[model samples]
Target: MFYGVSALGRKWSNRSPEEHVRRWGRIAYGVSILGFASHVTFFITRWIGGGHIPTSNMYEFMTFLAMAIMFAFIVVNAIYRKPLLGLFTLPLTVIIVAYAAVFPQEVQPLIPALQSIWLKVHVTTAATGEAFFAVGFAAGLMYLLRTVDFKKTSPQARREQRWVEFTLFVIVVIIAFIGSVFSFRGAGYEATFKQENVVIDDKGIESTTTETVEYSLPPIFKPFNSQDVLVEPFLGVKKPLMETPSWMKGVNAARKLNTITWSIINGAILYGLLRLVLRKRIGAAIHPLMDGIDEDDIDEISYRAIAIGYPIFMLGALIFAMIWAYIAWSRFWGWDPKEVWALITWLYYTAYLHLRLSRGWHGSKSAWLAVIGFVVVMFTLIGVNLVLVGLHSYAGV
Candidate 1:
């Protein structure tokens, strides 16, 4: 709040020197410093209490990522002196922290595979590198909002406007999704399914077992070949709309799908309400505040942050990841979903840099790439864990 107010005040001060908002800006920076200190303290205490670095699971990893983002934001803001950077960066931090809460918070003993220093090093370093990419994302998105023309109804401008609006909508979906999860959880909503699977051994012996899955959200999709052991009705709906496809090979696929469904439904409804009230595209609504902002500085921030992050990402996500994988699984790469996606993310930024430097992709084109690159990063981070069962499956909810 202080950062936001101070940024706005700084804007006002720029327009009218009589406002004298320097005092407020200093106070905001001080509070931000204090907040970062507290965040680090939490990390230290959690590490000490857990007897392991807290990057073992979704909750711990996301919190650590959020802290890294703040750390990056502080560094960038110090260098750039842009209070408005916090307007984008801090909200992203809050959203990530809130999204982390959607997962179970219980602390569990580390599995043997995770009991390695390499595992800790790989996760932390990778998250730190991704944090810089996230800062780049924030700046890139701000650049779009600042430069995209809200009033030009020409075809190209209209296309840009729609994509920008879509990006904002995705953010809303995340927020609404979190709200939906906690809302149902707080109301004690519960449903369970029983899935049966048959496994054949080397001796040609077949064994069947039933696996149970639970859902806090209404089950829009249930497990394949599963029966409702118990279902708590929501809004008069007692059964799932459909079953998860058999091709989806994850134990948690159904629950994850249902959660996504709720997020979209909730997001659409909330977005609709907001659109009606604002009576404009969300990006258009926001574009006015960015009127006097410099797009070039934002572009530079986006590029520099990504430039710094790419090699770190290469080091941690790929190099250290391969080392850890070799140590744990006796192979550097087995084409695990997580590993594949991390490579995809790295390739994406590689292309972004290539286009920016070699092919002359600049300004809005570069910004768009930066924005989409983070989406790839997010899928590599959260989406893979949620939708794909892999060696890193235990790292997720």
Candidate 2:
């Protein structure tokens, strides 16, 4: 409802044949407040029911992300009075909520690693920081759309516009991929695997062992074996033609790779269908709606968001994270993928600040950097946990 109202408000603001745009904007703001209130209620209910903070898994973190985005949007909009900011931020909150819905929602007991007070403080503050960065991303996108000369016929200008559109398309693909995975799971997709190994002891005693693993996505192809193979049909085919490589590290690596392949294929299909229907990139379609917004104000908001978020991000994602790491793992920094990515995110935002403050990079350049910075933030939050195997893997599942 918040998304619908905010979208309608943006549309009416753009083409105000009547003076009802402000009314719609007010309605949208009220709806956002209600949504935020409901989100808080849900979080409190879960925390009470579960006996702890609800930041242990993807579902919980994603919920926090949605709430944080809404909270940040409310604060920024209150300060800037930009109706379009709400219009931009609410859709992202909706997307995060939708993504959270894809994961299992049942509250479970915390694992040994997560049973710490730092879980609440570190994760919540980090999420809040990222939420502010999300606001920066929205403002940056609006700044670029308002300032960029998309009508230019020059090759370099056209290339830059294409890059922006490509980035938008990538976001669409990610959403589609998540949606596809959820649908596939709902439709009862499954995969089976068997492994056999021989072990020789110090006394030269040998033993043979066999193990089986089941997964949610059917393997593209299984390792060649004389033993009977369990095959499940998918899209009227028993299996894909290509086999996952045997060189992958973890036992579940092949399954992960297969799922990723399916996601990419689904993402491509969705992107093609969207391109066919829209006749232009999604970013291009939305560019005109930013018609009257001042580019300078948008740029300043983007800069201010980073300036505000960076310190909090450093404190939570780095300082608090390191403290937690020491307590949890007996190390200040382990170079774990999550830790490395968190550090990378910190450094990226630091560069964003230096570039903006020292080098006077503003308008399109700074805007693009802000957009890219958010992408890094997301990878740190989601990609590191999902694609990479590390101590952080349990946080995602």
Query: Candidate 2 on 155-210: residue-level lDDT in tens?
Result: 98888788888787776767876787677788887666676656699999999767
lDDT of 1 by residue, 1-397 (tens): 8766755564556555224345565677777788899999999998899898888889989999999998888888788876677888889999999989887777767899999998777887788889999999999999999999999989999999999999999999999999998899899989999998888999999998899998888899999999999998878998899999998776777787788888999999999999999999899988976766789999999998899888988999999999999999999999999999999999999999999999999899999999999999999999888777799989885
Q: Candidate 1, which ten residues in sequence have the lowest lDDT sum?
A: 14-23
In model 1, which regions exceed 4 Å deviation?
7-23, 198-207
lDDT of each: 0.88, 0.81
CA displacement after TM-score superposition, residue 286 of candidate 1 (Å): 0.6
Error of 1 at 68 (Å): 0.5
TM-scores of the models, in the given order? 0.93, 0.89
Q: Which residue ranges in model 2 land beyond 4 Å of their true spot?
A: 1-18, 196-212, 221-230
Candidate number achieving the greatest lDDT relative to the actual structure: 1
